[model samples]
Target: MTTAIYWFRNDLRLKDNPSLMQACMAADQLLPVYVHLPNLEQETPWGFQRMGQHRKIFLDQSLQELRSELRDFGSDLVEVPGDVLDVFEKLRAQIDADVIYCEQIQAPEELEQVALLRNAGFKINPVWQSSMLDSQSLPFQMQEMPDVFTQFRQQIEKNKFRFAYPVDHLKSIPPLPAIDISSTQSLGRNTISTGGKFQGGEQSAHTHIQQYFERRLPDTYKQTRNQLIGMDYSSKFSPWLAQGCCSARTIAKQLSEYEICCGENEGTYWLWFELLWRDYFRFLHFKYGKKLYSPKGLSKHLGNEFDSEHFFKWSSGNTGESLIDAGMRELKKTGYLSNRMRQIVASYWIYDMKGDWQAGAAWFESQLIDYDVYSNQGNWLYIAGKGTDPRGGRPFNVAKQTLDHDPDEVYRKMWLT
Candidate 1:
């Protein structure tokens, strides 16, 4: 019988997982594996752990959930630590597999991994399966995509596009081929979750999607998405979506169903609109390649250089602005942050410190549990005016933001005092 390996990258779920599905189709038997690259633990260009505590806990949760789900399919996920190349080389020898399959990754190092694997005489099947719209259905070619979100949204509307269907229930298979391997070990991040819990996986994502739609949360999203407090204020889908625990297409399909029942509005539309922006950033990665990481980023000759000490202070929530401090502290304490708070803190870092925007992006990369390459980098670039935003440097007024978003000093005192 044919044997193949399916490598799990950020895309972890089986539901609407095109890469997993394609792997199943191509192999008579499959080995599902997750490789943890140890080098990411090294310090970033900025002096911080590349993966922070909150993100590590969330990732551990997501992987554990994936293990449980894959168990239902009569397969188990095998995790290996060290350089991805070394791990894969070891796996190929152990499994003696015919081919390897994985989802396409747009980031610089990730793409380089694919090239290295392909050159090693392994057949690599990299599939596109992350976004709401299928690559084939987008109004513009991925390379020719519009510069702004509105232009992209209008084009998508004018063309009358639709989302792809969710994958059908998976079929059971015999337990995957096992090889002699040691037990997986935990990776380190400074913080650990004590009583804190964040639900993970396709099941939890689906549950949240149902609750949000049933409660008509999307209808009120535009108004409350900016709210700085509470779980119900927004969809809370970012953590799942960021790690590919849920597919954006699946969310969009359910969204269409919600609009059919409760009716559509700017609020509902904005969610999809944001999804489009997500897609745009992914496209940007594909188009620009390593440009996203350059000092200039996607813009021409625009960047800031500031004191590293100030960045550390801002990162640790000791900046001394109540609202900004509260947000930064919350981010330090929890991997999550409200969108408004994210913008506020980012503005403080950029305009206040006069620090390089890339440094702030790197800080977010270290701290955020839900940091998606596209959203995290895209947002940092936008706020710093080095990416798609024509208007650079949005200097937030901290005093006004405190009065506006935390008028009672409740959120401020809760985090900052």
Candidate 2:
């Protein structure tokens, strides 16, 4: 009996999962696995956990739901704790697997893991299925892509490229003999220092998506998307999308359908536009690998690091700018922040503090539950006038941002002490 292991990295959903589907098709017996790597706790150059609590809670919830869904598919998600390599090696010894299948990742440590597995003689198959528009359908090769986002977006639109609809099913697998692996053994609810917050999961993601589209999308998205107030302001899909509980294409598909049924407008279209930006960053990562994470970034390198005291003030949300402080405090407390607040705080870090942008990005990595490698790194560079941003440097005028987004001081009161 041929056995193949489907390792769940970021992609948690069963629907439209090309990597999972491929595993089902190629093997008679399937082992779906999720590895919780302890390396996530290792401190970066900045003294922070690589994976913060917000992201941790989201993944935990997503994995629970994914386990239930896979049970329906005549399979189960076996979770493993410890280092990824050790867990995989242990699983391989027990399952006698022929191959390992996972979603492709461009990030540094993730790619390194793939290399280690391949060196161990396990055939690794990674499928690219996360983007709104598939990489294969792009107008030009990633290397030959345009320098700026406007040029890239215009070219793609002018060419009239539409992404394929999402598939709701995974390929059927004949029930594989159950392995000795159990989720409890693989996933432990360890006490993580996250300033006392609960983790979010697939159930929350689904609920948020349903409510946002059904109740909130119609009235106030365009006007309120920039609002720093509450949850209903925007879709809040980033946490799910970050962990692959949902895909950009799935969200975009829903948006298009909603637009058609209710008549299209700037608000609905703007959501898709942001999704496109998400897609653009993913592709940009594909185009440029480790360079995206470099101190200099894609545009140019900055031989800079953060001032110890300045970084502490920024991370702790005590820079004295009420709006910026509020946003940072919200992130430290809740592991979530509105998009406008992210940009506002990021601008404060880069332009205002004159601190190293890399340090700021690292802090966001430690704090944001919805932190996707591409978006997090890409955006930091953009704010620092380093990435694909056209005019470059989205410097926030502190007074102007305060006046525009939080004139009522509602957001300020919530976070600023």
Candidate 3:
């Protein structure tokens, strides 16, 4: 009987997972595994934990939910903590599995892991399913893809790009080849209060999407998405989207249905526009590769300086600028901040505080439960004037932002005091 390993990475959910389906098709017996890499606890050069408490807690909740879902299909997720290479090496020896199926992550480190496995003589089949539009369906080839978001969006819209229909959940998965999991220890199993509005899981992701559409949230999304507070201000899909609890295509598909039922408006269209932005960032990583992680970023703009003191104050919500402080505090406390707040704080770090954008990006990577590498790096680069933005960089006036967004001081008081 043929055996294959379904290695879960960012793409955690089974529903709408093309890679998981491919794994099931290739093997009569499957080993579904999630290796919580030890690197998560290691510190970055910026001197912060790679994964902060907030993201760790959410990831734990997500893993638990994934395990429960796997059980329903007569399979179990092998929870292990260690180096991914080492864990997989042992699993391969035990099961004699030669093939591994997983999602393709374009980020440098993630790509490195796949490379290591492939070099070790394992056949790695990586499906590109993270974006709303499949790569093959794009009007231009990957290399020929436009460098700017506006150009990319225009071409995609002109070509009438469509998202793939989400795959259905498997009724039953292949039985696991029995192997000892005794050496494996669960990484995020400890119960901890998330203290955030969002919960992690495939079920929760779908439920949230259902409710958002049912209540016509998309119709008002354009207007309220920039708000500093309130659950209904935005779709709040990023955390789930970041963890792969839901696919961007699935969200886009639902939004299309919502528009058909409720009559299309600018609000509903804006949500699609935002999804396009997410797709753009993901594609940008593929186009630029390792440059996204560098201090100079895509544009190779030099002269960036690291200021530990400024970063510490900015990250700890002690930046002294009320708006910047409020946003940082909300992120520190909730593992979340509105999209508008993210831009404002990021601009303040890069322009106002004159700190290294890479340090700021690393801090966000450590903190955000919803942090996607592409968006995090892309946004930082944009703010630092080292990205694809034609305007060079964005500099938000903190005083004006405070006056406009929080004139009543309601948001400021809630987090500052």
Candidate 4:
């Protein structure tokens, strides 16, 4: 009787999960688990809850739906409260599972988790399934991939490479092991927000994309993607994508079909382009790894020093720069921010405020429901001129940003009041 543990990482949904499917095929009895990392409960170096209320509430919502889906498969999701090793050690004692299966995360910390588990005599399998394009299918080896975004996109287009298609959802998960999940292990009650702009889960993700396409939003994505306010202006798909409620392949496939039926235009092409950008960041991690997390990043330039006072003002929406303040407030309150506004606010923090980019990124990490580690780190490094393209850094003029994106003060007024 084979018993194996299937650990849920960022890839929360069962649909299109190759790793989960592998576990089902290999094991007779499966124990599905999601570890609520203990670190999230603590404070960051910048002095804020590592995981803020907005993100925690969204994650709980995602886990709730995942649990329901697993129940439908005659299995249950055991929410364990601890770090990877502690959680797995306890599970091993309970079930004596044969192996562990999970989606591979290329980030340093996640990689370290897997390494530690393997060193401790755990048989682990980590599958790489997060990006729209599989790393193996890229035109060049990951290490040799272009440093510039345009070069990466050109290679993809030049070779006519497209997205990896999503797989079907498992009809049934393997039955649970005989061992029962103790009630003591639960991560408390699942957080349910009274009302919020974003709800996280597989069902919510699919419903959102269905409507987004049905409304023909892609037709205008290029034009409206840069808008400062309103959901209709952008895809608004990041929150779900970040949490792995939806896979990039699923979105890309839907986009391809949308193009075939509705006819591809600048809008459709641009959406795909954005997806490529996301893939670029993911692949870059393969080459750079922990260096991306460094204060100097890939460059020799020393990053700015942290000023607690400036950080407070910028993060709390009290910076007195109307545009930056409004964006910060929206992110803190709604856990969502327009992409255009993100670059603007980040630029302001790095340049005008002369603040530490690492602190700025940490604040975003704390607040954004849509925060993906790769993109968050990559973008902050880009703006601070500490990344691969660290050519003098990206410094946006607050005056120009204000005039260009929020001249009407409509966005500013909406949040400031």
Candidate 5:
């Protein structure tokens, strides 16, 4: 009988997962696995744990939930800790698996993992399913896609391109291959839910999106999305999206139905617009791969010097600028931040503090529970003026932002005082 392994990466959920479906199709028996990589605990050059407590706790919860979901389907999930390559090596030998199937991740590090496994002679297939729109459906070749966000969005609209409809949920998955491996472990089974007002799981993700639309949240999304505080200000989809607990296509599909039911307006259009921007960032990796990670990204200019003292203060929220400090503190405490706060603090680091943009990005990577590699890198480069944007860096005036977003000092008082 054919045996194969289905590896789980960021794409945690089974619904709308074409990769998982492919593994089931190709194998008579299969093993599903999620490896907690060793690199997560390693310290970065910026001097902090690469993965913070909040993200780690949320991941444990997601894995535990996925484990429970798999059991219900008569398949089991293996949660183990090791270098991904090593974990797979042990599993392949133990099960005598013929091939591995997983969702594709286009970032440099994730790309390297696939390369290493292939070099080891494992027949690995990495399917692309993270973005809202399918690359195949786009008007232009991914390599030839537009360099700017506006141009990309225009082409998509001009060609009438929209998100691919989500696939039907699986009725039954292939039974697990009988095997005993010493490397396998269960999820830490953390009781803590997702950071601050969020819960981590496929069920939770679906529930949150269901309620988000049921309440007609999209009607006011554009107007309230920029607000500094409150759970209802925005869609709050990023945390689940980042974890792959729910597919972007699922969210967009719900949105299309919502638009149909409620009629399209600026708010609905803007939410679609934001999802499109997420796709734009993901597509960028195809046009420019490793360069996007470099300090001077696509430009001749060099990067900023790293200042350990100031970076410590800035990240710790001891910078003494009330607004910047408040935002940073919120981020560290909650492992989440609003898009507006993210931009303001990122700008402050690059332009005002004269800090290295890469360090700032690394710190965000270390902290954010909802962090996605593509969006984090793309946004930081945008703020640092190192990316493709025609306008240079964005430097927010703290006083003006304070006056505009938190004029009453209510937000400041909560986080600062």
Candidate 6:
């Protein structure tokens, strides 16, 4: 019998998963696996844990839900904890699998992992199914894609970008070949409270989407999305989207349905606009490659310095700038912040504090439950004037932002106090 290994990376949900489906078609027996690397829990160059407690808890919960769902299909997820290559080598010793099927991740480290496996004589079949629009369908090639987000969005809108319907969830998956998982341990839970606002799982993700549409949240999203507090301010889809419990295409499909039922409005259209931004960042990784992670970034801007003292104060919510401090405290406490707050704090770090943008980006990577490599790097580069933005770095005036978004100090009071 043909046996294949289906490796789960960022794409965790079974619904709308092209890679998982391909694995099923190629093999009569499958081994579904998720490798937990030790580096995730280790300290970064900045002396902070690579994965903070908040994100760790969410990931652990998501994995648990994924494993349970697989059990319903008479299959199981073999979670191996170690270096990916090491675990794969161990698995190969036990089972003569022909190939590994998984989602394509554009980031450098993830791409390197695939290369390492291929060099070891394992056929890797990676499906590009994460974006809302397929890469092949874009009007321009990755090399020729626009650097500015607006230009990209206009081209897509002018040409009328279209996405394929999401694939249906499998009713039953092929049973796994016998393999021992007794040595592997599950991801550890966080002692930090999640504020009971977010839970990680495909089921929970779908429920949130359903409620957002049913309660008419889309109609007011454009107005409230920038607010500093409140659950209904935005769709709250990023955490799940980052973890792959929710697919971008599925979200686009649902938004289209919502428009059809409720009639289209600016609020609804903005959501689609935001999804386009997500796709732009994902595609940017293809064009820029390793440059996205570089200190000088794509623009090759120079003269950047890191101040550990300033970084510590900024990260710990002791910066003394009330607005910046409040946002930092909220993120430290909740593992979340509004989109507007993200930009403001990022600006303060790069422009005001005159600190290295890379440090700020790394800190976000360590803290955010919703952190995606593309978005995190892309935004930081934009703020530091190192990425695609022609105007060069965005500098937000803290006082002006305070007056504009939180004039009444309601948001400041909530977090600061």
lDDT of 1 at 13: 89
**Alpha carbon lDDT of residue 31, candidate 4?**
91
Candidate 2 per-residue lDDT, tens place, 70-96, comes to 887777778777877788788788878
Candidate 3 overall Cα lDDT vs. reference? Answer: 0.87
Off by over 4 Å in 3: 188-191
C-alpha TM-scores of all predictions: 0.95, 0.93, 0.98, 0.97, 0.98, 0.98
Compute the lDDT for candidate 5. Answer: 0.89
Quantify all predictions' global Cα lDDT against the true fold.
Answer: 0.81, 0.79, 0.87, 0.88, 0.89, 0.89
Candidate 4: worst-modelled 10 consecutive residues by lDDT: 186-195
Backbone clash pairs for candidate 4 read none
In candidate 2, stretches whose alpha carbon ends up further than 4 angstroms from where it belongs are 183-199, 216-219
Local accuracy of candidate 5 as per-residue lDDT tens digits, 1-417: 988899999988989999998888888888998888889899999889999878887777777788889889998888788987898898887788849999999999999999999998899989999999988888999899988789988999999877988887887788888776445775564545444577788998999999999999999999999999989999999988998999999999999999899999989999999999899999999989999998788778878999999999999999999999999999988888999999999999888899999999999988888889999999998888888787877788988998989999899898997
Q: How many backbone clashes can be found in candidate 3?
A: 0
Question: Residue-wise lDDT of candidate 4 within 50-146, one digit each (tens)?
Answer: 8888888888888989888888888999988888898899889888874999999899999999999999899999999999997888889889999
Candidate 5 residue pairs in backbone clash: none
Best by lDDT: 6
User: Clashing residue pairs in candidate 6, if any?
Assistant: 385-393
Clashing pairs in 3: none
